[model samples]
Every structure is written in C-alpha cells, then in structure tokens.
Target: MTTNNGRAFTAPQLEGAVWKKSSYSGDSQGQCVEVAALTFAPFAGMRAIRDSKNPDGPALVFPESSITGFLADLADGKFGN
Candidate 1:
C-alpha cells in the first residue's frame, strides 16, 4: 500500500506542533504564513504550513524533504513573481 504523507491536518491534530512565521511578514496585512515542525508519530520530521491569521484552521503537512526542496526552489525564483 502507498502511504500518503501530505495531508491537511486539523488544528487539534497539530496541537503539539510549534508554529512560526517568517520575519519578513512585518506590516503585511493578513498575508502572513506560519510553519511548524512535527515531531510525533506519523508526522515526525514533517512540516506544517498554515495562515498566520487563522491559527485554529487546518494546516497542510508535508515531508521535510519536500519543504526543503520547495524553499530552495523558491529561493531560486522557480515560481516567477
């Protein structure tokens, strides 16, 4: 069976995760995002992303490798602005 690691997790499911936002989000009105590192079972080494404005909302979880690669691509401007 193929395991799906990327999934949208509920607030309660991520209660143990520590969320953090970007430093460049200052003065941005409702345009900030937060990321948390998951350390529990079935979520270890995973990353969770969510809107900073909605702390109680669902969060998208991804593997550490995926998040790292995505950040690298982002830094390389893979997704043109």
Candidate 2:
C-alpha cells in the first residue's frame, strides 16, 4: 500500500484505478487535473491526483482529511490571485 502523504505512484501501481477530472474543468484544452478515489483496503477513503494530460504519469496520493482541508482552503480563497 502507498502512503497518503503526496507519494508518487508508478504506472503499475495505478492499474485499474479510475480517474475523473473536476466538474468545473472546462473544455478549453488547458491544464486540468484528475482524481481517483481509493476504495480498497489500505487506500480506501484516500484520493489520487494527476494531470489529465498525462494519464500514464505519476500521481500524488493524499488522505481524505487532507483533501477536505484543501477543498476548504480553496473555497475560502486561501490561495488568492
């Protein structure tokens, strides 16, 4: 099992995992990110993120709590323009 602390995963480690982009991701063909929920043991409740343009590339894994905090900060505009 991979650690849920932004560890990068190899191609073989992501086999069979389904990835989906954000709903707000427009069809501008610009930069977009994809996330896959880990539902199996040892990785369940976690999320794997990657660049939509690089399907076979590495993915950053994070725990569910971390994702929640990130979303909260995003909603709060913590990373301002």
Candidate 3:
C-alpha cells in the first residue's frame, strides 16, 4: 500500500477484509465510515478506514497507536465543536 499524508493510503487489494462501521454511525444510510483491521503481514496491527458509501474505494491506513490517540482525543473533546 502507498501512504498519503501520513494517514491515508491506497492498497492494491483488500480481499477477505471484514469492514465494520461504528455503533455511533446512525441510520444516515449514505453517510458513514467503516473500519477494518489489517492483520496480514507488512500491515498487521494496522487499521484501515474508509467511507461506507464507497466500499471499493481506497482506505486510509493508520497505525494502531494513531487510532488510539485519535479516539482518545475525540473522547477528551480536544477537537472543539
């Protein structure tokens, strides 16, 4: 996979991946995000995020630490409304 802006990436293939959306993803239907864990070699322990509206589109891969920090910050309200 190729990295983009240190947070997003483009994988050549992602077969067998099981994508899941957040529980907070309401019934907006067309607007939501999905995440999948890459447990294969070279990408093991990494997390992949994408727009649920486009499952076949590219995904943004991030290290597990990055995902943790992002969620922590979100919970702490670091990103003001």
TM-score of each: 0.86, 0.85, 0.81
lDDT tens digits, residue span 1-81, model 2: 649499998656877778899888888777899999988766778888999988889998899899999999999999996
Regions more than 4 Å wrong, model 1: 1-5, 27-29
Task: Write the candidate numbers in order of decreasing lDDT.
Answer: 1, 2, 3
Extract clashing residue pairs from model 1: none
Off by over 4 Å in 2: 1-4
Cα deviation at 69, candidate 3, in Å, is 0.4
lDDT of 3 by residue, 1-81 (tens): 444334655545666667899888888786889988888766678888888988877888888889899999999999997
lDDT against the true structure, per candidate, is 0.85, 0.85, 0.78
lDDT per residue for candidate 1 within 1-81, as digits (tens), equals: 222556777899788899899998986765899999889887887889999999899898888999999999999999999
TM-score of 1: 0.86
The clash count of every prediction, one per candidate, is 0, 0, 0
